[model samples]
Target: MRADGSGSGTLSRLEIDSLKAGVRIEDLAARYVPSLRRVGERWVGLCPFHDDTRPSFNVWPDSQSWYCFGACRRGGDVVDLLREAEGVDFRRALELLGGPPAGATAGRGWQSPLPVAVPRQSEAEPELTCEDRAILNAASEIYYQSLMTNAAMRRALQARGISLGTAQTYHLGYATGRRLARYLAWRHLDLERARCLGLLHDRLSGEDGANGDTSGDDVWEHLSQRLVVPVMRGWETVYLIGRATREAQRPKYLGLALPKEPLTGRGRPRRSQGIIVVEGPFDLLLLHEWGYWRQFELLALLGTQFKRRWLAHVGPDDRLLVATDQDDAGEAAAAELMAHFPGQAVRLRWPEEYKDVGDLAQAPDGHKIWARALSDA
Candidate 1:
């Protein structure tokens, strides 16, 4: 079927098979179930379709299918899962999975409107208001101060090979979860505005007078106990993302209610050798800690999906070093990026033992390996 739901020419069987083969069920499932984890040969996570207390949803990588053995009691392939989860028709789901092959409908009268690429952030994101900017800037300062006072957070940074200086330079902060509301109150800032920006969540019961009173323990910080990383643009905190410092934190990462953009380093490089693209913020952080910023500008996609908006950072002369994770999703992203940039994009392959650059950070010779990879690139 056509992506626009028109009753025109149907997609060829080859196109359908190619979509199923190209996109992994587990990777697509993870978007709905962030808590999904591997179990033996399959993946298991809490069923997102129902009130699943225990993990009953299972995904088989080999078969590329998922089944929820919970109250929902549903199972299907990647397309089926996407259709059910997103309430989209088969044609829409196919469109979302990078659409049909380019010339699948060459002889047909209608042309496919879908682009042969992954979805990207909108070209223009809504600009943050002055009040919004004030709230984010204040929250950034509050989290930075909290990180400074917290000895454990400092040790955590050290363990990750991130120096205190690097942390400071990047404005890395820790969320105590309790201080932000009070800090905003003290500074005469708008608590509701902060809450709207996803920095806070309403925790007060109806009995506590729901009159938007956020100062009196009525709100909880959204990024509590997580390491906060603010994406800044010339002194303005344009975005905020938090990483789980502890293992028990489900989903592992959280961010504000804003369009996902690449987490970039402050200031331009001294000499633009190339742009290193990574999957996670921590991977970018470790590279900065190792002093790669001297020659190369770092960018973290925050995930495998590359947003077209990030193309602004790539110059015609600057090469793109794709250092995504060594997993299926990462490999797919790397391939897509290379296909997009052609000869200008190079995949930086590390040892198979390491899943990503962040995993390499734990190794004793990680810095050496990273330097060698860049040297080779």
Candidate 2:
């Protein structure tokens, strides 16, 4: 019943279950995942299914499971990792683990060793066809749900005068526990698909070699402790920016690497939200809270660079508001925006006392000064 004279890729559900139950999570993960080591009660490794520069994958033997906290966010038995890493069908993956051939039967009256139930994918549903947008939506929902329940993140936003209502309005969320991988596993999402979306790290260069740095900032969970601000084009999530709330955390902001072509304005623009390009999400939030966003049609550049896709659909009448920070990089970015759109651009200046919009918004007599500047503009 096979096309290539080999057996079909189908295996009994019971046989696959037996293979998983018989194998240890650590052993399975170590075989496919690289540079694995015991970390306290669990094992940690770089995800083979993605471009992992740091260890985001973990295996818990007691639970007989593994999860990748990074962009992959997928967790399951070693069998899942095998299927992903080897790029093989489910039955082929099981065979690689030395499981019995297809059509093999368990002995009479044989009972499963573990009570856990494995999720089955129908023969008609191929794993290669996972939806990237759905994966991002699921991951974004997880972060949003975590943000609402996180008291610390809520307090930090409140301290910055960002009310819960405003946060929800802007879709501000949190990534806690650095366990997004486990959550994805529970949700039955795909790690490989998420990688292509720039949500997960790519292990392209030097992945096979162990650098042994274990730098905390580059790991998947680095986003876990930060405030998650998603860049959305209508219902679709385009990119994610994580702002560090803790003083000890270096590099105030981190974001995913959008495809170079798309970032350079090659793709279709999502909406005509008006191009009021500010440097950061907080800057955009401050302006929104002060009623400047709608009056000027604001958007956060999310960084200093200009992207083609973000600007591809700009209308001739669409206005440009360059409210970059006073810092060197910010000034440079603002100058670039001005040069890129000469006649249509309006350059906004920040007060000498502050460096960015957030600081300006929090300064004494901030709103009056802002109103005067906007009026002049």
Candidate 3:
């Protein structure tokens, strides 16, 4: 809502070029830009120019410019970085960098357009230690393997109309109590990491301990007869293990066993290509079935209720479409989604005769309904 166009003490191309050569791009970006993170040697962050999380936004310390792989496709020196991040132009960025003493233009407050308020991102994400990334990847690989060959689990997914290919693509797996625990231990995972990731738990005595022994119930508790769906943080499964209801369970639904901290520390990345927010897990799965899978990745809120904290995770350019059920509860959920996303959110209501995604999938115009909602762009 606040726009400052006054342009003054801008950094000269020569000075910016010098800074790029002198400072590490990651260091320079962290010092000037908030919320940007150090991915490897290069500094990566959400693209302020658009909503995306592809890690496509890159800052070159040598050139002192930034480039977003998403919509803006912008690439320039530090001047350009400031412009995109602050919604300013080169002159204004020069003023910001030159500081008030340099007679540059007056500076404006740095604030994100998203609803939640926070200090600009500080360069504080401890780089993912190799050990950490390895542990996570290993855990994920094992879980993924389980989803493939596990007999009971495969049957459960089939019953839910989910295909084997879907399970594999999402890296889904049932937590066969002993196999998962053994896998973690084999990888030399510390007790804390396994516990924090929600992969370890007590099944035997109902004792509250991380990495507890799994009995028949405990393995099933994490994934028993349920349809398992993995929520990946990039390539790693951060949280989420689900199961479909057993035979004829009235309120048929898949559920998530969130990590110890229900809200993980990381927030949504900026500069994602786009976002598709649906009410249930299969709604995301169903949308994928309709071919909106690539451009629009799905986010299942686990339910219809909107969490206020979720607003902070939204990217500026990201478009969120709500695909709720045709029932009253679905309508209520859709209203809540619009309350948060406003014009960016469109309710994907089904036809009068159909119920929800499940019914639509079973109905004749199912493909048409999917086509209508996805092409709403």
Name model 1 segments beyond 4 Å from true: 1-123, 204-216
Task: List model 1 lDDT by residue over 202-221, tens digit each.
Answer: 55233121122334576767
Q: lDDT order of candidates, best first?
A: 1, 2, 3
TM-score of each: 0.69, 0.57, 0.50
* lDDT against the true structure, each candidate: 0.76, 0.62, 0.53
The local distance difference test score of model 2 is 0.62
lDDT of 3 by residue, 114-133 (tens): 22222335454234456655
TM-score of model number 1? 0.69
For 299-340, candidate 2 gives per-residue lDDT tens digits of 677766566456766667777767788775676676666666
| Model 2 poorest ten-residue lDDT run | 259-268
For residue 328, give model 2's deviation from the true position in Å.
1.5
Give me the candidate number with maximum lDDT: 1
Off-target runs (Cα >4 Å) in candidate 2 are 1-130, 195-222, 260-275
Q: Which one is best on TM-score?
A: 1
